[model samples]
Target: MTEVDLQEPRRVPARAAGALRRAAPALLAYAGVRALGLLLLAVWSAAKGKSPHTLLTARWDSLWYTRVADFGYGWEVRLPDGTVHSNLAFFPLLPWLERLVSAVSPLSYGDAGLLVSWLASLCAAWGIFLVAELLYGRRAGVCAVVLWAVLPVGIVQSMAYSESLFTALAAWSLYAVLTGRWVSAGLLASLAGLTRPVGAAVVAALWATAAVHVVRDRKLSWRMAVGVLLAPLGAAAYVLWVGHRTGGGLFGYLDVQGQWGNGFDGGLAFARFVGDKFTSFPSALAGLGLIVGVALVIWLYVLCVRRGQPLALLVYCGIVVALALCASGYFGSKPRLLLPAFPLLLPVAVALARLRTSRSAAVLGGVAVASAVYGAFWLNGSGPP
Candidate 1:
């Protein structure tokens, strides 16, 4: 045996050990930081003249979800014209989980919301960590989970919102795809579609990846074709059902949103809405802040592409962001809605890993504390209340 042969054998185990060692520290740090953030959220919510218990149960979106689980989808508020403002418009998975938790726990429908989000967010964090670790290595994965835990939108993770559930499904679904677990990926993609209309983006990414593989090989294998074909049925079936029930075409969902003063074409029109805010000083500053935030989102997406992100993840995040932004309604929820696109967390995580360990930990810790404090205040109907 020559020197070159001995060197190859030595390098393999060394590399493997190095990877395991690098990954373990980041994983431990990620879990610790998130645990602290959650504790802060609970404590802060309690201190603000509100019961953290009630805050879990009584908030606006939480109420709707509880209503859906307690009753069923056909519940609606009607306008004079008889247009159905149905809670059915919301997807079923989160409410289903709420009902499941309530059945097993002593909690009310409201507290169950918190329980579900709390558990789901941790799962989401883990799924995201695994995906990031696979793509950019363990340090980036750790950073991604930490940043996600401290995001300004972190409050919603603790709310009854579907962000955590959606993130878990999307992240793991993508991971399954990356690992070529076709059936698991497709099943997850389908359920994700049922979770939110944008779950269609996950289905699309799955199908596209399979299709690309098929085309590359010049023949469609049954596993690949079936996996690609099966992914979108969940979203399509639900949306079409909404259309049938509402007596609108498949586009009835859009019409329903129109009733709420939302529709897709007007997002660009929102630039003017932001601009007109400048007529007042405080409003001008708010508009500037909004502009800055949107700029950051756009810049992050570009960074993902420039950093040579995997094609499937990039397309998945891109389509989801575009759909969320272009949708005709609920401008206020765009930030929260886009929160599940875990790919957006990647660049921020990469940046965090570059700082000195002490500095990075402090910066991330400070953001988590601030987010927790603000989240508490906001939930209490104080600042941004």
Candidate 2:
């Protein structure tokens, strides 16, 4: 049994009360940080004569999701350059949830989307804590949740976006894998795939771990085989359906992303995007900051590897970083895209766990305030796209 399973008499979440009590501290901290961010955003937006509620629920991708939820796909925006931005690019799971919530409640599509995101953020926090607590200890788990909460882009977690939903699914999936619950892991991974394209990372981790187990131990359970089979179903099903709809076969999704100027270009495009920043004097500092941020991400991944984190986490983190950093377009969205990569913060959390409670609390508190301010400023501007 794993560390988490050791003290537990049961593994399923049927003990909802027990699970909530165990995760209360981390969840509360995460909620507190997000609440601060929301409050700051409201104040900032009020001063600017904008609506914080609109920023969170009706802008950018949130609008696209609400569109998808309100009217099923086939909606396309034809650009001046003839490029087509299609609603088919968005996966179905989030919209589906929004629809479900709207059907059950008095909330409109945007409000339902916001409600779903808020609840998913809590689930993500609880899952992050569980994974960290299992790997290190409860203290490290709490620290990880707080650190994740205080991320400068952490305010995105409160928005009507898929990051929190996807992260919640991915984290719990990884935890299920670690605890030898292969079927549970695969099921969660499948759902995660339906949430975001990075869901493939979760499937990859599951398959890789299952492969390692089979090869090394020369043993495989029926559960393991079933899990391996189930891991990719969500993504595969959607991609295939898109292909069938567009009559482009398997490359339909790629065509959609290409029209959006997004793809895995091995960071060449991203490098050029950063390099262009130095051509002007004022933008050079932003470019430098971007470089430092990328370097910090790389450094943390290296630490996770050197520290011998579980293979599942390494695979998940590596793919997440690679995709977010290497995508050719939407540089501003990189940080938000990387939000679900909670594993990269585990090393930081583990390190912070070494400090005295008072010292760590002070440090995290200061950072939280800074993050809230930054979040307010970020959303008041062009926010995550």
Candidate 3:
């Protein structure tokens, strides 16, 4: 081999070590918050005579993912009330990874799913940090990662759910778009599509950003053209396959979601659901809280726009918030759905970054503890369905 070729292997480790050193702060903060959550969960579960591991790996949608991993689709449960819940409604990427991990290791499918989620959550934090660092600064980037980890619903990041995987793909895809890496963005968007139904947000962001570039330059490079073409194939392929299998034609995927009572009603169903909460005295507070929370979300988006954030971040965050709020089913899942919209926290992160480092650390540390307690309580009760 040439001298250059001989030197390349040594250079690879050097580059990886440099990257790890740079990312260490954000990664460490992410791990600390997650460890806090897990610790609280274990204590609370022990007190309640429940298994924390089961809560993380075997409950709620985790079970659905593991089932899909073990048995490749076509599984359904028909309830006594005549509703059919099909595993086909879920996207396939997470389960595919779970199966791959289990096949190569001694881990069970559930354990594999949890492991995938944990690794993906760390990747998601790194990607979030990179995006923030590109737009703001390193301090803002670290703050953003910490803020994401301390979200009230952050425990889902540690569970065997697709949120972390989908968020990781979405964040990196957005980073790729911001950096003008069209092909990389397209590939990540395609993978995000396979990971979750909301991958449409990533696809839309790619298309929107590409269109802006083309309009401004009055030219489209062949690479960008190819990327735009490749972006939607993953989601389209899976939906088409579902359509063929269910004999529902082009709308098969929608039909499958309909079976689960989920659909996009432009927030009408959500408004009604929130309104109905006011029927009783106790629920009226919840109704008021819902309205305020939604208003805050909208106001934050407005801040993003006014702050002159990139078009890709704006489009992605807007679509994610819209989808989360507009979905008709699972009234309790709105917060978890909105968890991946980390860009919405940029304004907060920026504000935090401007504070003294000691003060910021204190605030973040307190929030992390509170979030851990809440996560434990949530899982011990009626957690995400």
- The lDDT for every candidate, in the order shown, is 0.74, 0.90, 0.90
lDDT of 2 at 150: 97
Residue-level lDDT of model 1, residues 259-350, one tens digit each, is: 66566673675677678889999899989987898788889899888776766687799988887666656556777778887798887887
Q: What is the lDDT of residue 181 in candidate 2?
A: 85
Predicted model with the maximum TM-score: 2
Clashing pairs in 3: none
Q: TM-score each candidate.
A: 0.86, 0.96, 0.95
TM-score of 3: 0.95
Give the runs in model 2 whose Cα sits over 4 Å from its true position. 1-15
- Error (Å) of candidate 3 at residue 147 is 0.4
Model 1 clash pairs are: 262-328, 262-329, 263-328, 263-329, 264-328
Which 10 consecutive residues of model 3 have the lowest summed lDDT?
Answer: 1-10
lDDT of 2 at 113: 95
* Tens digits of per-residue lDDT for model 3, 1-385: 0111100111122254665676789999999999999999999999999999999999999999999999889999998889899998999999999999999999999999999999999999998988787677788989999999999999999999999999999998888788777887899999999999999999999999889878878899987887798888889899999999999989999999999999999999999999999999999999999999999999999998888778888899999999999999888999999999999998899999999999999999999999999999999999988
